[model samples]
Target: MDSINVSELVERLGSDEDAVRKMAVFKLQGCVLDPSFADVFILEDGLTKLRHLTLHATGNTLAYSLTSFSRLLEVDKGWEYVNQDLVERVVELVVTHPLVNILRGAMSILVFIVSHPYTASNRISQPDSFGFRALQPAMTVYPQFLEMLVSRLSSADHALCANALLLINSLMREAITNDSEADWPKFIKQLQDLDVIKAVYTLMQSTALQDLSHPLIEFQALTKVLLRKWRDVPVDLNKSDHRRALKSIHLASNPERVTTPVDDGEEGSKKRHNPEKWRRLGFESETPAWEFEEVGYLGMMDLTEYVRQQEDGFPKLLLEQSTKLSEQRCPIARASLAVTSILCEHFEIEKADVDDAKIQLSFESRTNFDKVFKPLILQWSLLHTAGLQAFFRLWQTTGAETEDFMKIADLVRILLEAVVGGATRVSDVHEVETEIQQFELARLRHLQMELLELTYEDHWGHHLGQMRDELDHEALQFVKEQRIRCLLAGAWFSNGHGHKSDNVAVAKQDLNPSNPTSQRYAKLAHNRRFLHYADFDVRDDEEPDLEGLVEKIDLTTVSSVVLAPSEPSSSTTTLKATHKFISTRKVTIYGYLLANSRPASPKIHPRMGSTATKTPRKEVTLLTLHPQTQSLAAEWLDGLLMLLNYKPITDETKRLIAMVQDYGLKIRLLNVRFDDMALAGDSPEIPSREGLDEDYYYDILGN
Candidate 1:
């Protein structure tokens, strides 16, 4: 309908003739569905006329007016004109109205008003304004309304039950937002008094509602909310009857297993000791040991068994629901799994055991579980974070052994594929000028590092190499820093233990006490006090004479890098001042470079000179550069690690490197420079470097 027709209908709503007003309201109800008509209707004071009709009109007219108001209130602007008075009138109608149609319409208006208070401006300003308006009508009547809704849950009409479920869910959610911590328990107690849980559970287990997906899904959501809220409420085990009922439910849900009968024959004995049998039960028994009485004891105990051993609680009820829902392949199954995972976390249950139990309980076999969960993990966006947590825990547990190593390898491959997919999406953008595009690129790089860490072992080198070959080198750094981190985490750096070095080459030099140049050189080198030439080229022919500097000052006793007290214009000036004074000026630092060096044992002489004694050793630092800014140093370090092809020495070091990559330590490195700049209260002035723009830098770095 057009705006002119809608305006004409609104005018007719004020007609003296009852049939004319009823017809106008019926026509306007359909008209209000169109946004333009609704805008025009509201503009023509249609809500005032509708309010009158809701009070004076009967039957279909009242229903149509309520329905129109519900439709109009859906628009965000519509709520601006809605006041507490209108909400109270609707709540009154909901309480007094006996007709199903009027009740549904009135309840729907309340639903839209209270649905997401944050979505409507006026509602947020007064936090749960609609809920308070609806429920504040003499306390007794509001409880009656709640009881009325709960009673509808058991009604034969599916539509009534569904509407009732939706409104209850909305009201419960609003209560959680508005209700204070102290009052929350009282509110829950009120719900229990009305038998709300019983009614919802009836709807959940009702075979009649099984085909009705909408109501069933809403029921599942309601169950999750109730479980989450009730988790904090302490269980009352003081009552003997309640405890007995709880124990009965727990035993019924988790029955003791029936042990297999042992036969005296050779075939039965072989069957009892079969490795495949133990493996199928989630054990890693390659060969049967006759010495051990209980072979698969630890493996057989899962989360369910652990929970059963503890005192009976509400989680057992949720676990039962989850197990039953697992038989279905709908959204409710996913919801059930998510709720169970959350409960497990709340109870401080071991994630690995929970994952194992989830798989064992949900699927008929390991292969079936793998087939279902593998795709879910690959499509992780479809799963909730709780579900993902469970899946990752399972993967971590299974991946620790050789039995399910292929599955772990496949998971690594899937993660790599996701990284590649992210990069592909970034590349697909026409110009990577938007912050979102940059974020996508960064997210992908992070994914790459995580994958690198997961496959840090040498056995998974082929997968890592494959990913490296497939990824764009210009875009992705290819785990170069992670490899260097692994090397640093090893004993070589941490404990000063040496490994076989392949990067640096040291020249053999004779330490002769009689020759002054050789003696000074040995003394200076032994003292470990030398200045790093920042601008010195390895190809430079005019190197500083260490013997000449050593004669000027006793360099043997110095134990730190000596710098010029004043800023030097050239390396020559800095080298000349090495014997004068120590300086603390901060310079632009880069990174460290590792070089292969052979160790020489010292043979002390009476004249403060040592002879060269050859000893086998590994790598040593060729040069060390202190970082003025962490981010720049990280980039330089990554470049060096990539160029040098460093690898971690120990498995523990590899794990630590993997953890570092997983935490995005490289990304964190950028924060140091930004924080320093922030502390200095200065905006970064970009140097005139090629392929750099100030605006582009701000676009990427700014929020």
Candidate 2:
């Protein structure tokens, strides 16, 4: 290399042709690694000017030079000149740099600056929490820059446009494949822009580049990068809306991933974001991975994210209130619908496994499982106010929407439709006698289908006790029907009505025209087989009137609904599941409340097993009635153990033996106080009634 051409190279390093300047600056730096320049370049101002030239240089010209300069500055004692002002300017330009490639390599400088002990210490001392942020500028500008990059993709300059899009797209794909979201909104917005859509669509139209045939790169960026970031935020650090409003971006992004499943590690990483990436890396699997990706999956992430945030806020009472309002049971319903919606999206993914019933968790029972929404509810409902609502929703959907229940409803609908189709195909057997069974099948099937629809819709809107008021909301109709059905079921099903003699006549009267589902079952009104549906207080009547649904449910089943505690609804029933009833064996123990449990239809009969019989599920409790504060010592463990058949042995007890292993709950109880009621009553203090055992916490919940 030629020496002493510093003057010429500095001039050229600022040239418009980035490649020429990049080569010149890099070449000059290698030659001048010599320490002799220290004396000749002694003036601090001269070094400052050089530093400015290196830092402010654009594109390759600047990036190539800055990489060496960053090294040189550290190698020299040049950091002595660093101050708050200089550091800020250096960080600002590195962050706001317009060129994508220039910005990419330039971030290391900010990373370098903030990584210094003094710098890190200085940042933490300040209140804004920006010391760490200065190092990760990608978090702030990434979303914005992604927006710009995406817009450029639709440009008319084919070569530049295609090259730029290809490079940016690849970088984004690599990031997503790594399951990283260095900057989510910026990154997603770019891919979602029209340029990406048009480029993929236009490429598909022509058989130009065989490489352009796949759109996995774009989709991976959308789901793994964008949507995932939006949903899978750090719970403690999150600042997103509970409903996932950012998903409007998906409208511009490919939506196939909503139904696909993800693979583990690198085999999955290269799948969608870039097929060539997979090919280049020598990872072998089918190109363009689409499994574990889907809208339903995204929905799960969104709701789960809210739960995670709620989880983070559990310690702060005021914050817990906000989280409860923000997440709580609504997400449970949302996730329930979302998983069910996934079933509708792809028929083949789930081959209908036998254990689906076993694994199929109620919104109440599923706690801490990754895809579960229940843990989040438990986290929120632990609050004094939200507990009851959590319990109510849990029970409301239990009998009406157990996985077994939905499965049964599905079977009925399918058989009914099959019968209807068969009746349509036959012309000779059109007589009323021949069609009676088919019609009956269709009617019963329709009832089941409607019930499924009811359970699928969420009754709670944005707040507890606040019913969704929009008349046009189809979801509201589902809630209203449930309310009416429960109301009518309350009054007529109980023996208090005293007309328990002719069951057929009762069924027919309940199925009369006034009932919601009566059209097909009207004949039952005369036979006393009418089913009491619910009770409702019509404004015109001074008293709540008794009404019934079109079908006759078992009276024993209706009695199980604990409608308003001792006040049984007309729909009361005692019939259990098809299996034998898990007789009234109750115990008190501790576990999280599932959610707001509402009264549900009575249990179904149990299935006859070959050897080991299936355990019957309890009628999930409707709305957890929290024990009084004064009763924590005497009642807390006893009441909870009653439900789970569990008792606290000692802190040394293992989880398998201990029915409840919730850490957060144990913390809450420590702070909770029950007043000394005996002192107020002048009966003297009782040692058995107060104070928690310190050993229990240190062994179980304490660090």
Candidate 3:
């Protein structure tokens, strides 16, 4: 096409006719391939028309326009024809365009325009060459563009999300170049703040998006850049610091800093600025492998520190999602494992860095167990098998010597203490009944075998045996010193609130918009449910303080633990409670605290022997649903019977027992059994069964 035809085509691209505009874009695509057409395209203001066509055109027309634009920029000396206005328009389309394909096209054009060689000759007259000048417009609008692109990462449309990722990667590549160098610290910090890297990683791992074809290479490129920066650049250690200031500290910034630069064929091109030549010479590829191949002792410590940093700043949403996705064996969970494994490898490298003789075995033992391994193991235990595999792989690779065994021993001690608490149990017979309980037991057993193997008959004199013996002794002593403890909660009923103690304040209920009158009735009812982690301690004489969910009940309380079925409500209930059980299965504990007594006689209920005598005792009845199952309620009943010294003698005691029996409660005597000597009583005070050879069992009922 001549200059006259270029001008006509540019005019026709802006024509009202869609077909005319599409034809104009199609012709321009061919014209842009010729070296002589650059002047005609520039003089006729073709870029402005092309940008308009890309934004306004639809379907094939838009695709044609984008192709034409990219070809124009890719041609020799083609970038010099571009200007700031045209760049801005393309970026605007990239950010706001509804179609994923169009967005990808616009992004492609933008990346090409920014990175393409601009001048006719490759030689640069000055530091601010054509490539640098062309990129200045992009840098000016980058923050806004980046914000928009990052927001698309969470789009339900995987294709849109994938394109958004590619756009961001391209933008990052352009920004971080030597020509228009981004502030690496600031740029990376912003990406982290937006959770861009994490979001990309999650997208890569999402099972929901697994079937959809995505730009994995682009995603990898973006994450690699981010990780490279995370390792290379200094970032703020304290995430809570809003400023996100980079610290002066640096660690292994460049392992191959002395690698000489190679001369590229581009005569006047700076080798340092030419990323392609650097990639070709293998500096970028080779350096990471060398630096990360083996971590020294300090490097291991550094890895530990990185783990700490990640754990502390891990997002709450991700934590919640981890539990849900862990069992799914999804990409996100695998990604977490991959990350953990890499860090573990770093630990191995670091451990190798320290000579075995010079290594402070005691310090390594303590730090590995307490600071590194134990904390991770405990926190990730909920991850089940995947979590176990990660830590186990680390353990197997890093150390298996005596110190490592000691660390394992230390880990076992912690798990034992946490799971058993103060239970006097050293039995091999585990009550691995429920799935959760079974998982806990299995983990304990795994740890036990692992620790025991180091101390068996062959290595009797090893420190492992001594540690095992100490552990066994500690276990027995702990069990004897500790009282029985269990979690419980308060369940609300039709007539009254579940919480019997006035000390327990009722939580206010939320107002219902549809039925405003229900709010007033809720206040009048005064019954509030308290459901939180509650503990019942048998040793304390003080009444259980109902603070939030947990409570500690006194064993000295004069009362009985009764299981009662919930009474059906006579009045209409709110929508919130409609789906809930109409009649809840519940347990009610009746007691009287002497501490709440007054000299004056309280008004007794007419049904109770109309005695208005002068001992004002506060009668308390705490009610709650059976935690886990009703069998637990029965266990509570039995435990309370043992602690409160229950026996029916007086009519009142018999009546209470009869009342408990009336409510389907199993009334069993607290019977303690022993191998050395059997207590001669229908009921024994301390209901624990122990023998010199057998494991301990707490028998609540006699044979």
**Which one is best on TM-score?**
1
Scored by lDDT, model 3 comes in at: 0.42
Question: Estimated TM-score per prediction?
Answer: 0.36, 0.24, 0.34
lDDT of each: 0.44, 0.34, 0.42
For candidate 1, the 10 contiguous residues with the lowest summed lDDT are 491-500
lDDT of 1 by residue, 1-703 (tens): 5334666787899999878988888877776777877777778888788877875678888888888778777664466555666676777776777788888788778788767456466545765355634455533545577777778777787776777777777777667657775565566557768887667655544555433334444444444454445433333445453345334433544433444555755443222332233222222343222211221111111222333433353244344433432222112222223323333343232322323443443544422322212111111122232232333343434433334434333443343345323332113222211222123434544555565455353333454455444443422344554434422331111111121111112112222223111110111222323321212212233444444322211222111221223322211211111222112221121111112323343333344232223443222222223333333233333323332332322233344445544454434333343234343345657676888657653345656
Kindly list the per-residue Cα lDDT of model 3 for residues 395-465, writing each as its tens digit.
33444342343343344343434343322122111321122233353465455544445333233334434
RMSD of 3: 26.2
Residue 452 deviation, candidate 3, in Å? Answer: 18
* Candidate 1, residue 28: how far the Cα is off, in Å: 1.3
Q: Which stretches of candidate 2 lie over 4 Å from their true place?
A: 1-24, 28-50, 55-63, 70-132, 135-703
Quote the positional error of residue 163 for candidate 2 in Å: 13
Candidate 2 TM-score over all chains jointly: 0.24
Q: Which candidate achieves the best lDDT against the true structure? A: 1
RMSD of each: 24.3, 29.7, 26.2
lDDT score, residue 310, model 3? 45
Report the Cα lDDT for residue 514, model 1: 31
